[model samples]
Target: MPFNWNWAFTWEILPKLLHAALNTLLAAGLGYAIAVVLGLILALAQRTPSRAVTFVIREFVEFIRSTPLILQIFFVYYVGPQFGLRLGPWTAGMIAIGLHYSAYLSEVYRGGLQAVPKGQWEACTALNLSPAKTYWRIIIPQAIPSALAGMGNYLVGIFKDTPMLSVIGVAELMHTANAIGSSSYRYLEPYTLVGIIFLAISLPTAALIRIFEGYVRRKLGLK
Candidate 1:
């Protein structure tokens, strides 16, 4: 068969993809925000002086990190209702993505924390800085650059993984593409467009993260 392009069909599906893309972006954004904050908390918990606290935190992080995200999504979605908790598709997807990525981000944060020099901690102690002040005022500033690249990578990673949410009925790009394909029996255009849309958004964002990471490392004099 000769090559054929259906411009009108492509145009007709564009708005659906755009709407789904917005939902995808929103899920990624909110999920990433939760990951960032909760990862910091997990990082801090690991660093707490109490060995019991550290052990518990490590176990929790490892458990979450080791499990597959799809299973986690299924468990949260299907099992939650049994416990008197109900979640919409979007809400469950966001929570699963957030919690799963938080485990990964926590390690990124922990690595950043470990990268800070012993002298820095000693200096803070010698200065009689409270633990909170030590972390917030001194250690974190230095650790942040180390964490920034990893955190940025995860942000892009989560964005790319938004398609996984579609399996759980969250109406993201992949779901939208599936809908279009099912309705029109035209998978080629819709699926291809989804990939192109993802690349158009993600590739630029990844490049920008690299540029910003370089600038940050140079500014911080990080080796």
Candidate 2:
């Protein structure tokens, strides 16, 4: 089979795809922000002194983390209206992404917290630090550096997974590609462009994450 590549087609579709790409980025950014904050809350809940409460929190996190995100999105988009809860495509996508990633982020927080030595906690106790003061002033400061890479990795993870939002009719880059392909009956240009756009965004974001991680490590005197 002879293959034909059309520069004209690529150029024409690029702008539309770029527009959709912005929505994808927006969804990822908002979802990641929510995930970071919500995950911290869940992680803290798991560490609370009450055994029953901690168990419940841990189980909830486990349930979410174990499930497939696609299913979650379906539930959010389709089942939501049954309870008189309705959301637009973008809103539903953002909520699903936030909720799904929060479970994973909670584990990241838990791991970072655990990495802090028992000696550090003992030292805080010896200093007669209140629990809140100890965590706020010492433990969290120590934990941030350890959590940086994991948090950064998830930022890129969320970006890559933005395509999944297309499943629920969210008009992100992947959905744009699908529309273009369906209209033009050509898959190569649009699909390849989508891949290129993802690489362009994710590669730079990942590099930035690495730079931040290095800076964090240096500040913490870890290396």
Candidate 3:
């Protein structure tokens, strides 16, 4: 059959897809939030004095970065139940995505932390500042600018990766699109709208991230 764009079908399914888009956003947002915290911990853990601790965390981060995200999602949702940890699709998806991105974000943070000058570390020591205070008040503040760009990129990346959650039945946008297409037998409109919706959100988000990065730099007086 020749390709035809059906306005009626498109309009009818718009609300369902839009509702699922909120799930997409929720997965991305909560996963990124988890990644932001856990990635920092992993990065800082590698900086600790004990070589054993650093080596273990370093290997763990590398392992996570090396693996496929889909495997992680499957493992968490399926295998986890074998270990007596039964979680819903939403929870499993969030944990999997969060851990996956945390590895990437940890590298971003490590680079940012390293970019801080040695002089600053010495300055903190000379001032008799505690390790916790030095890191929290000074090192992290300076590192934010260097890490902000990578962080923003991963924010978008995690959003894109949310489609993978559909495999585990997370009911994100792609899942809804697939369901709509399966029932209605209209693949083009549903898939096309999915792309358009992603573009609609992602393009503006990329622009806003740039603006926010600039604002952060200026506010930190690093501009």
Candidate 4:
């Protein structure tokens, strides 16, 4: 039989899908927030004086980045309980996603931080600015313009990857789409809507990221 579109079914399931999409957004937003902070910390840790600390953090980031996100999610959600580290599915999923992406984001941050000129550090030293002040006042402001575009790309990436959270039953968009498809025995409408919803969100987000990047560059007088 030839396939056909089902507008009525699409409309009926959309409210449910939209509700699930909220969970997706929450997971992505929270996860990205954790990633941004943790990634910065990881990047900074590598710059510290202690070689041991830098080595350990570098290895940890490498390990996280090298592994599959699904494995990490399953490990956190399932294997964690074996080690008496039990957490709810949502919590586990968020932590896994955050840790997984932080590894990548840290590299983006490292590149940004490195792109700041050596002369800026020399000038800060000449002015007797403390390390903290040097970073906050001079170095970070410069690094941010270089970092904004990469950071924004990861924000969208984390949103798309929220589907991986469904493996642990987090009930985000993909999980909900699967549920709808299973019940109705019709995969086409629900899955197609999922694609449309993702496209709708990702495209605008990328565009806004570009706008925000340009604004930051202008504000910082980098342009």
For all predicted structures, in order, the TM-scores are 0.95, 0.94, 0.97, 0.96
Q: How many angstroms is residue 206 displaced in model 3 relative to the true structure, after the best TM-score fit?
A: 0.6
Arrange candidates by TM-score, descending: 3, 4, 1, 2
Using TM-score as the measure, name the better of candidate 2 and candidate 4: 4
Candidate lDDT (C-alpha), each:
0.91, 0.91, 0.96, 0.94
Candidate 3 lDDT, 49-85, residue by residue in tens = 9999999999999999999999999999998889888
Clashing residue pairs found in predicted model 1: none
RMSD of 3: 1.0
- Say what the RMSD of model 4 is: 1.3
The positional error of residue 113 in candidate 2, measured at the CA in angstroms, is 0.5
Which one wins on TM-score?
Answer: 3
Candidate 1 lDDT tens digits, 29-115: 999999999999999999878999999999999999898888898988889899999999988998999999999999999999999
- As a whole number from 0 to 100, the lDDT of residue 178 in candidate 1 is 97
Give per-residue CA lDDT, model 2, range 38-58, as digits (tens): 999998889988999999998
Positional deviation of 138 in candidate 2, in angstroms?
1.2
RMSD of each: 1.8, 1.7, 1.0, 1.3
- Per-prediction tally of clashes: 0, 0, 0, 0
Cα error, candidate 3, residue 171 (Å): 1.0
Pairs of residues at least 3 apart in sequence or in different chains that clash in candidate 3 = none
RMSD of 2: 1.7
